[model samples]
Target chain A: MNRLFKKYEGKLPLKVINDIKEKLPKKISEAKLKKILEEVVMEYNKMLVQPGESVGLVSAESIGEPGTQMTLNTFHFAGVAEMNITMGLPRIIEILDGKKTIETPMTEIYLKKPYSQGKNIKKLALSIKETKLNEIVSEFMVNIAESKIELRVDEKRMESIGVNYPVIQKCIKASFKELALSKKGDSIILKLSEKEKELNQLFKVKEKIKEVYIQGIKGITQVLPIKKGSEFLIITAGTNLKKVLELDFVDKTRTISNNIFEIASVLGIEAARQAIINEVFKVIQNQGLNVDIRHLMLVADTMCATGTIKGVTRYGVVKEKASVLARASFETPIKHIFNASLIGEVDHLNSVVENVMLNQPVPVGTGLPGLVTKVKREPEWLKNKH
Target chain B: MKNINVKKHMLVPEHSKLTKKEIQELLEEYNLSLNELPKIVSTDPAIERFNVKLGDVIKIIRDSPTAGKSIYYRVVING
Candidate 1:
């Protein structure tokens, strides 16, 4: 046991070391222990990637091969009728492209303590759901004669969303300073200021009133509390990660948004890298496909290595390549070549793509090694003696 | 200045800047030059917390399903 511990002292993690120690027989001979340690070390070393292996190509092919077989569809969140997560091939493309705005941005918000244990989860979910003015209003009637627009509030809807009449009135007044707002019972009346009180102005005011922010978190269109592993968590259709994290009831450590770029900007690039890996893994797993997490991690590392999230496209990571020929080989060869030539850029051809483009042996695998020799002449005295 | 703690993040691997002696030992063990190894920018988020400079090497320890744990070395270069 001491021999095993000494052998793997700093090389292996403490958890792995302890696990091996617990699994081995307490009375094992020194030779047997040594043999076991050797086997474990050999297995670990074999799992490591070789020095000159093209990890980028392997990762791309690993993901791309299975990516073609993925379904092009969105998956409905389990037990939540209103929310659907973007999944499959289209979602993969969206993520790899590093799009700023995805078709459907969502977040899974885990709650802390009491909330996760099913304490007023329904009411909490309702409070978290964003309620726009148009969603809570029953109808909007524009009176041409009075040059005013009247919005009838839905009492039940407003009550359910926990928004009061005064709150709606205040929101409308704060948002639209050009219009005068007055609340009477369930209806709110809007009229343009006297100086600009044209008939056409009322229609514009009516349109603006429809988009007024009434209550709840902005950008989160819907929120549903679903039971997951005996704990209830909220899943939101739209994402507002920063705002959501600010809530006192949220488990900030576990709450995450599907949008990687948002996570990068708000959390940091490290978090963004993790988000990318998780998002990709979730998509692949949802489609019943098996992909090694290492490949996804490699891709994520490449995207976030420069302290920012960049896409694999020409405008992103490809554009940042150091070699001129490497960038030209990606897309629009002429443009990249011309731009490089204009600046007198140099191409070292150190990477695989540039060498492959030039029909040269790539500096990977067998081509990584080179032979060199030095010739020395025999001394005249030694030659004469011979 | 960001409030989010990258070190506490679940996905980020543990990172430490290698000393000069350690870097030399690593190079000798791998039979590689500084440029031959993979590179990471000095501003990379994983190593941002460390007081690393250009040409410094950072050691990253990641949890791997197949290997139990894996160690990787990357040289820090200017962005």
Candidate 2:
């Protein structure tokens, strides 16, 4: 079986050969196997994309036609009860628009070995979530006469997250150096400086103290430990891929963020390309659409071709076109034309849109190749007669 | 600290730099200039291990759902 597979190794892809090996009958004849392999090669050849095919247009139409049917809404993913992720059309638009700041940035964090098997999973989840002062503070008491603010700490909450008063104090001291801190039974007192003694100032200090960062990885607002298959992984509302991956327990290889820009910055352009394809395809699949993955690949390839992810929007991928007319045709036609004239930019008429605008046979499909026909005899006879 | 290989990730696929001879053969086979090919930034983490410079070609092997596997070539460019 191995020898037979090796014979057709270059002819068929490794995946196809492996698939054949898995599905082939145990008692099949050598001739039948050879015949099957030949047929597969022929089919694969037929599936190859033809030259001069307008794949961009086909992909645009395939995706755009299905996009109209998608619902504009957010849905909570399974196991993540309260977090609402932007899904359907809105998600597709966001990915394609290359919006740097996504509406709902999320990360699916996979853990290593023992931690993934529910060992201190809750503790791990809490440690990854950003804890603010407001979350652990039971009450904020303002004493106007004393020019001080007292914060009653929730000991249970603090213990659950494994944070102590010193940690909170250090965090507050780092953020607010001017304020003086003192400790009471269960409350931490913050005395306002002489310069800031007004009643309103005390109220303002109370509000500011409530938002100080205490512990956990920053930007991760919420975390839910979910049991997927046999392992428990975390699903976070906010994304901090760089910080999350730095943790010792995180399975860095499999952890991924939904924010494309964050992925690009943390991972790279290739990862960003994959993220775009996955995100768009996920939204399309969720909407019950049947568009081919090749279209999504084309979109991803185009977006990442220039070594960076550019959206399909006018300011992104469209702005980088070689043809001036093509850029003008997309949007802001007058402005594009004016800019081109000012710079004395030339329109090469290399693309389909510009040629169509010029009422010529668009340089696509059959029009891509030029004809060199002979007409010497007819031209000579006509010239002699005239 | 144990270094994590970004290339080994499921989404990253396999990326390898093409030799000068291989790149020449590919350019001739496709009838395309080096600049005409798709580009990947030098700073892309997927190719960080390669220690690639500008104008180098990278061959990417990706798993395709339609076809079993697809191969792509991209030239390295500035970030």
Give the DockQ (C-alpha) for candidate 1.
Answer: 0.28
TM-score of each: 0.83, 0.90
lDDT of 1 by residue, A9-128 (tens): 666556667688889876888888777777877886787689899888899999999999999988787776767878899999999998989989988999999989999898888898
List the TM values for chain B, per candidate: 0.93, 0.94
Kindly report which residue stretches of model 2 are placed more than 4 angstroms away from their true locations once superposed: A1-11, A19-40, A77-82, A193-201, A373-386, B1-3
The deviation in Å at residue A255 for candidate 1 is 0.8
lDDT of 2 by residue, A1-386 (tens): 57888998878887888788999988998889989999999997898778789999999999999999999878977755678999998899899989999999999999999999999999989989999999999999998889988999999999999999999999999999999999999999999899988889888878888889988888999999999999999999899888888889999889999999888877777788888999998888888889998899999989988988898899899998999999998899999999999999998898999999999988788999988987657677778998
TM-score of 2: 0.90
Whole-model lDDT per candidate: 0.82, 0.89
CAPRI accuracy category, model 1: acceptable
Best by the lDDT measure: 2
Best by TM-score: 2
